[model samples]
Target: MIYIVLSIFCSVTVAMLLKLAKRYQISIIQAVTINYLTVIVLSLLFFKPDFKVINSSAPWPIYIVLSVLLPTIFLFLAASVKHLGIVKTDIAQRLSLFIPILAAYFIFKEDFNQLKFIGLGIAFLAIILTFLRKTEAQSKSNKWLYPIMVFIGFGVIDILFKQIALHKELPYTTSLFVVFCLSFLVSIIIVATMVIRKKTKIQLVNVGCGLILGVFNFGNILFYLKAHKALASNPSTVFASMNLGVIVVGTLIGIIVFKEKLSKLNYLGIALAVCAVILITLSQLNAV
Candidate 1:
């Protein structure tokens, strides 16, 4: 329970940091690059992953894909927050759970009970309602592309992480280290290219923000993994709790701290999202 709470706090903190970054006019790319560097350092110091275990037969392909996708999605997340506000962006991110659930039904042919099906239905409706805006100008200006990409990107990343978890040859921590290293390397190349093109200048402020972001970012992942380990047999509980916790907490923070405005329909969508999570959780309990 403590692990779950810590994970939720870390997750929300990362979103909050990104929101603050936008306000401070920090460069997202530079911050993300430095964040990856911090992640690599922390991963090495804590996990101490053995590099020699990595062989030709290792899951390099998945690692490579994740390495590329992680930072890319993170950038999209920042953009989503900047354009769509934290409330909608957070909701869209939490809704990504639907992607893996749908994949299980189709690809893995997992059994879906009535509760799960109904929950999925409500989740779909919730997404539409959550993103719906009243004014035409607001709708036109706040492009849906960023949040849409975040939803899909995070979902795909989740699926890939699950695949990595299934592989027993290498430790999850080691795999994480490899992914971070690759991601950092890729970031270095991107930053170099930007420098050459004179697109942006690197500043210490961005690096400082990235360092703080990195701590919470890694904390979110680490504590979530710990919660999973603590509740090994109840993965669904962790999954539902984490997603719902983020939505509930993030919504409150956005409204209270940032003074983000939402229509009544959006609030109703949030209610439906809660129901969807509850139903999904119940379905998991029933399966167990």
Candidate 2:
């Protein structure tokens, strides 16, 4: 339970850091690039993944896809937080579980129950309602594209991660390290290009910010994995708590600290999103 709480805190803190990035004049690309590098160093020290298992038979295609998508979507996450605020951004991200759930039904042909369908319906509605702005000016200037992309990008990334997990030949940690290495390489290329073009300059503040982001980002993953391990018998508990926890924490921080405003419909949407998660959890438990 403590692990779950820590994971939730770290997840939301990532958003908080991104939200503060613009005010601090931190380069998203530079910070993100260093973030991946930080993760690489941490993975090496902690996981110590065996490289021998990573042979030609490994899932390079999925690894390559995730390598590109991870950093790209990370940039979009910053944009979404900047425009849409933490409340809507976090809800959209958490609700992205629906994407893989849909894939399970349509692509993987997994059994789908009525409760799951109902949850999906409400989740979609919640997404619509949560994104609604109060005024005309706010609506017009709202960067809806960024949050929308975050939703879809994260969903696709989830699918890809699941695919990599299915490849049993490679241990999950090793596969993770490989993917991180590739992602770091990709981030470096982008950062290098921007530097060469004189579009951005490397700065110590960005590096410092990136290192902190990396710790929390990696902490989120580490603790979530630990929670799952600790509660191995109750996978749904982890799923429900993780999704719901982030939404609840992110909402509080967004509203109280950041002073992000929401309409009545937005509140309604948030309520529905919570309901959707509970319904989805119940459906999964029933399935099991």
Candidate 3:
């Protein structure tokens, strides 16, 4: 439980910091690059995961897919943030959870019951509710298409994570390191493309901010990896819980810390997310 909560906190903090970075006038690409590098260093120096588990033939797809996928996902997410505000963009992205749960059921042979079904429905409703806009600006800007594309990408990433965790014998940290390492390489290509197009430059601010985010981001991944390992049979549940927990914490931060308001439906959406996690976890595992 502590693991799940801490992971959620890290995830939320990452967002809040990124939001803060915008005020600092940092480029999103540079910020992302810095964040990933910081995570890579911490992973190498502190975690010391045994990466050999991912070396075998079995780990190939998980290793290869995430290696290529995440850099693109991060960029797409940044774009989504730019086009859409943080709340709607993220709430829209919650759709990413669907694939992993469905994939687990079919590919991993995970099982559940009616109660779980009810819970999932409720949680999803909550997420949608949270993004239910109060202002004309937010309502007019909610583009379903962009976020749908991003959702598919993130969904695939989660499937890969589930596969790597269940089949690969490597320390979860090792798989993460490999994933981040690949994310780094791919991100470089992305950065080069941006440079070639003369879209942006990596100012020192970007580097500095990226470093801080990277450390926290790496820790976020590590913490979630350890938690999933503990609840390996139903890691999708933990993933859902962690994100939903972020929503719970994020909403509070939005309200208390940021003085963000919640309409009637938004509060309902938060409730839905929480309910769905309970259903998803309990039904999926029958363990909670």
Candidate 4:
């Protein structure tokens, strides 16, 4: 439970940090690039990942895909927080679990119980209502695209990570290190390209922001793994708590601290999102 709580905190904190980045004039791309560097260092220090086990036959395609996707989605994550606020962005991210669940049904051909079908129905409604802007002017700006991209980007990334998990020959931690290192390289290419184009500048503040963001980002992953380890017998509990906890915590912080406004329908959407997660969890437990 402690690990789950900590993991939730770390997850929301990443969004909060991105919210703060703009106020401090931090460059998200640079910070994200540096964030990958921070993860690599921590992975080496903590996981002590053995490189010798990696071979040519390893799932390099998945590794390369994730390497590109991780940092790219992170930028969209920042944009989503910047434009849509943490409330919608966090919900979109958590709801992305449905993507893998959908894959289970279609690609993996896992049977879904009635509870899951109901949950998916409500989740779709939640997404529509959650992103509804109160004003026509706000709606016209199309900033909603950020969270939409977040939804798809994270969904795809989730699918890829699950694919990586399927390859048992490589340890998850080693695979993590390799992906992070490659992501770092990919981020460098992006940052370098932007630098050459003079679209953004490198600064010490971005590095500092990245350092903090990396700690929280890595903490989210670390504590999530720890929570799973601690509750190996009740995997469903960790999954439920982690997702529901983020939505609940992120909602409160976004509204209370940031004073983010929400329409009544939006509030309804959030409530429905909670229900959707509960139903989905119940569905999974029944399957077990």
Candidate 5:
């Protein structure tokens, strides 16, 4: 329970940090790059993952892909929060659970009971409602592309993490460390290219923001995996709690702190998101 709470806090803190970054006019890419560096250092110091266990037969492909995808999706997440605001971006990210659930049914050939199907249905409706705008002008200006990319990108990242979690040859922490190393390398290359192209200048403030982001981002993953380990037999509990907590908390912060406006339908969509999470959780419980 403490792990779950900590994970949720870390998740919201990441969102809040990104929101603050936008306000401070911080360079998102540079901050993300530095954040990856911080993640690498913290992961190594904390996990002390053994590198020798990695071999040709190891899951290097997943590691490499996740290395790229994690930072890429992080950029998308920043863009989503910048463009779509925290309320919609948070919901879109949480909704990514559908991707792994669908993958389980189709690729893993897992059973999908009636409750699961019903839950998926509600989830789909919730997404539609969440994206619905009150006016055409607002809809046009607020491009849906950023949040849409965030949804798909995070879903794919979740699927990759699931694969890593299933691999028994390596400790999850080691795999995470390897992925972070690769992600940091990738970020270094991107930053270098940007420097060459004179696209942006690196600043101390961006590094500072990145350091903070790295702590919260790493904490979010660390505690989330801890919660899963603590509740190994109750993954659905972690999933539902984390997602629902982020949505509720992110919505409040966006509306109250940021003063972001949401229409009645958006409010309803938030309500439906809670319902969808409940139904999906019930499905998992029933299966158990």
Candidate 6:
């Protein structure tokens, strides 16, 4: 339980840093790349995850998916930050339980209770209500398409992650390293293009933030990997609990500290979001 709580804390902290990175003039893609780079370096130094497994004859598609996931994540997350604001984007991203839940149902054929499905329904509605704004111009409605696209993109990522988990041939750490390398290379290409086009400058502070993001991001992965291995009862429950906590804590901080505007509907939506996790866990109590 402590591990679960701490994982949520780390995720929320990362979200806050991503939100604050704007003041440092760092964009979201740069922040994500920096964050992943940080984790890769840490993985290199402290973790020493089994990297040699890549040479094994596991399967090529897994590596392909791993590579694709990196760039998709970087781009999807950046789009989310741009279109939805940090808080809503985080909610939408974390609230992507639908993808995994459904995937789990079809792929692993995991048993699902009625209440968990009901809770998923409510969580979906909750996300919609929270991002409402008074005027069209003041709201993220202008760039809403990006967030929706980001949602679909990340949903695929989470689903693929589950597939990766179920793969007997692929270990998690090797998968992580592979995905990070691919993402890093993609980021370099992006940065190089920007440099050639003179679109954005990669500043010293951006690199520093990337370093910070890397630490937290790596820690995020490392801790979750443990939790995944430790809690054998219900992985979905853990995923739901950790991510929902992120939404609650992150949304509170966004409102209290950053003065994020929310309508009555939005607050109600937030409440519903919280209830979704509770209900899902309750539905899974039999398994746990």
Ranking by lDDT: 2, 4, 1, 5, 6, 3
lDDT of each: 0.90, 0.94, 0.70, 0.93, 0.89, 0.72
**Per-prediction TM-score, please?**
0.97, 0.98, 0.82, 0.98, 0.96, 0.87
State the local distance difference test value for candidate 6: 0.72
- The RMSD (Cα, Å) of candidate 3 is 3.4
Candidate 5 regions off by >4 Å?
none
How would you encode candidate 1's per-residue C-alpha lDDT over 22-118 as one tens digit per residue?
6788988899999999988999888889889898877889989998898899999998887777888998899888999899999999999999999
Clashing pairs for predicted structure model 5, backbone only: none
Give the winner by lDDT: 3 or 4: 4
List, residue by residue over 1-288, the lDDT tens digit for candidate 3: 678877877777766675576578888777777677777888888788675555555576677778788766776766655454455445545556767877866887866578766765775676567666778876776464555567688888878886776754566667778778878887878888898899987689888888877867776777787798788877766866876777567666656765556688877766676666666656755645
Output the better candidate (2/5) by TM-score: 2
- Compared with the true structure, model 2 gives a TM-score of 0.98
Q: Please provide, for model 6 over 1-288, each residue's C-alpha lDDT reduced to its tens digit, 9 standing for 90 to 100.
A: 667877877777777776776666786666666776777787777667675666657555766775666666556666556445667777777766667777778877998889888887887887688666668676745566555665666777887766676766667676767777777877777878877899887787788888887777777777776787688666776777787778878787878877777778878877887888777767777555
Give the winner by lDDT: 1 or 4. 4
Residue by residue across 214-246, what tens digits does model 5's lDDT show? 999999989998899899988888988998999
Candidate 3's TM-score reads 0.82
For model 6, the superposed segments whose C-alpha errors exceed 4 Å read 105-111, 136-140, 233-237
lDDT of 4 by residue, 239-266 (tens): 9999999999999999999999999999
lDDT of 3 at 146: 55
At residue 102, what lDDT does model 4 achieve? 93
Q: On a 0 to 1 TM-score scale, where does candidate 4 land against the true structure?
A: 0.98
- Better lDDT candidate (1, 3): 1
